[model samples]
Target: MTEHVDVIVVGAGISGIGTGYHLQARCPDRTYMILEGRAAMGGTWDLFRYPGIRSDSDMHTLGFAFHPWTAAKSIADGPSIRAYVEETAREYGIDRKIRYGHHVKSAAWSTEDARWTVEATGPDGPVTLTCNFLSMCAGYYNYAKAYSPEFDGADSFAGRIVHPQFWPEDLDYSGKRVVVIGSGATAVTLVPTMAQTAAHVTMLQRSPTYIVARPGEDRVANWLRGKLPSKAAYGITRWKNVLMGMFFYRLARKKPAKVKERMIGMVRDHLGPDYDVATHFTPRYNPWDQRVCLVPDGDLFAAINAGNASIVTDTIARITPDGIRLDSGKDLPADVIVTATGLELQLMSGVAFSLDGQPIELAGRLQYKGMMFDGVPNLSSTFGYTNASWTLKADLTAIYMCRLLNTMTKRGLRQATPYNDDPTMKSESFLDFTSGYVQRAAASLPTQGERKPWKLNQNYALDVLALKFGSIDDAMRFSNPGRSKDGRSTDAGTLQTA
Candidate 1:
């Protein structure tokens, strides 16, 4: 016999924890379980153990709206963030609801029964579970593997090569010359942190990336905590950061050239006039097309100024036994090479899906309000904002899902799905950004319609009005076992489940 739950939440990460909290808080009568592939809590925080791993966004916004972040530092380290997530789980008894090492292999929805029969591989062997609703909080990328591009002659390198995603526990780079390949957030973070002890560190990139410096300790948040209550302080800081982030993002989109100049000029001010800003700091693409890297207190620049770190802008020709050979004919000498390459994009945790024996092709389906896919019933996903704090969107999504569940119960609906009625609407990429991970996963991602309810605007304020307060009836039809799959009203009374 298969165990059954009101809802099955995949993945026990930040998003999953938030989902569990909301379900318990808002819909206490419902039963749910979080299935985690890994054996631990704190999803990304536990997975990544690199030297300087930290939240790119401030904790004020990264933290759930229900929980107020009381830390002094706005930019927190990996361990601290991990503890925060764990604490939240323990506080809400969500820790008891998580089943570790349960990898969900597939989810099959039955229209006749109005349930999802999920298959998984647990430690004991194959496991079966069923749920009325499926919540996907497994994140957007592959957890089992990082995106490792082929570097010519990489096998010939003598020193230990490490990827930031899967850093070794005992690997040591202290007092050794290290070369970090790539210019993304991971690389920028690793450079300064490793530079603290490493003999010398170099950040080598094929092209430049926009980077900004901010104070690690937020004075405003600290001051507010001293005067106001913790929750009050957290709320104010969260909005402040949100508005500022939006202002900068809007400015970048409206005046790309001016924003580009301003961003480059900030680097010059930090690294002095003599540093090669154009070659190392100025990217070819416009700002906001790709995410801008953030460094707290200009630590990366301080490392460069201290002669502990340096930046190189060039592509790799190949890896030699001694070091990396750039296409520009420069050989970066290194005792160890750290590949800060990005993550592999994975949709639905590579889980197979079927509807009444028919395989579900998600790629061809249209995204419904960035969470639900068209034609897929009793399923919702948590996809956070790319430009703002991830929790900002996750919190709203969790709250909205609970509200939806309550509505379904009140209306006597067994199944709800988004149905696209506008045939003439244009199709766009699901995500609005131009990041490499997104571009690589374009073929696998769902399509977004050109208008509201089908499209996803990265703006949180608009999403608040639409997702939080907007009607769930439009573009979405609710149905019960008595009604047809298209949600046609019927007098047949068989069962009611939402």
Candidate 2:
């Protein structure tokens, strides 16, 4: 017999766990289960085992709104974050509702039944389940694959080539020369970390990224933690960080040239007058065009200053047996080459979705309030912000989802679908980011409108106002409380609201 739940959450990561908490706290009567494909929880934290793996965003904001991060370090390591997520799950009893090793294959929505029939591959074999609502918190990246561009003569490299997503546990790099490719977060992290034990490390990049250094600990937060309660301190610090981040982002956007000058000057100060700041640290685009790489306490800069690591700004010519040959005719000899490339962006965790026997092409659909897709009934996917910390948006989304669920229950509605009624509403890319990963998967992502409810503001303060307090009935069509399986109304049912 197939089991049934009020809601089925896709992944048991931060988003899923947070959603679980909200459902329990706000909608105590609703039953939900989390289906995680992996053996353990902590999705990204558990998957990535690379060195110097830490959050670019501060923990105070990255941590859940309800949970307070008690750690001294604002820039937390991966293991600590994994533990924090697990601890939150255990505290709220969300871990008990998770079904491990359940890889969801596909979902079919039935308008007549007003529920989703979900199929998955479990340890035994194929398993079937049903849910009134399906919440996809499976993250935005492909876990099994990393975005690795084709490098010429890669096969003839002769040395071990490793991707950061699938770092080997036993591979030793002690006292070995390592060359890390890319200038994003992963490359910036790996360069300093590998440089510690390696004989030498070099970061190779096609273009420079905006890299900034910040202290690992927040002094104000630390002081507030001692004087105030944990929750109060956390709340204050979270808002403080949020406001500061918003201010800087607005400043960057409004005065790009001025902000760019200040940012590049900071890098120059770090590397001294002799270092080639323009070539190695200055980015072609303005700040936040892509994400700015954050190095805790200037660790990456320190590594370079100590002669432990170096940066090379050039394109790859080809891979030789000994090392990589650059376009500038420089040979970077390496014992190990780490491809700290970007991630393979995936939508709804690449699960095949269908609605009432018709396949759902997400790319062609419009995003509704950055959560639900237009014309898709009883489904919502959690996609966080590109500008700010992911959890800021994620927390608001979970809260909004609870509000939606409660509203549906109160109105005796079984189906809630977003409809884009305005034909003149122009569609735009799902994300405004110019990052390579986003651009690579642009054709596969959903679209947004040029106006409210369909447009993503990317601002946490604005998102909080829109998601937390916004009207739930705007542009949303709700129906199907007493409808038959044959697409006929069995009773008059509740009034249809849009």
How does each model score on TM-score? 0.96, 0.98
lDDT at 314 for candidate 1? 83
- Estimate the lDDT of model 1: 0.89
Candidate 1 lDDT by residue in tens digits, 1-498:
789999999988899999999999989989999999999988889999999999899999999888989989899999999999999999989999999999999999988788999999998999999999999999988988999888888898888899989899998999999999989999989999999999999999888889999999889999999999889999999899999999999999999999999999999999999988988898999998988889999999999999999999888999999999988898999889999889998877989999878999998588888899887888998888888888889888888888889988897787888888677988988787778888888888888888878889889888888878887777877777545668764534433221
Clash number for every model?
0, 0
Evaluate residue 18 in candidate 1 and report its C-alpha lDDT on the 0 to 100 scale: 96
Q: Which ten residues in a row have the lowest lDDT in candidate 2?
A: 489-498
TM-score of 1: 0.96
lDDT of 2 by residue, 392-437 (tens): 8878888888899999899888888888889999999978889999
Q: Which residue pairs clash in candidate 2? A: none
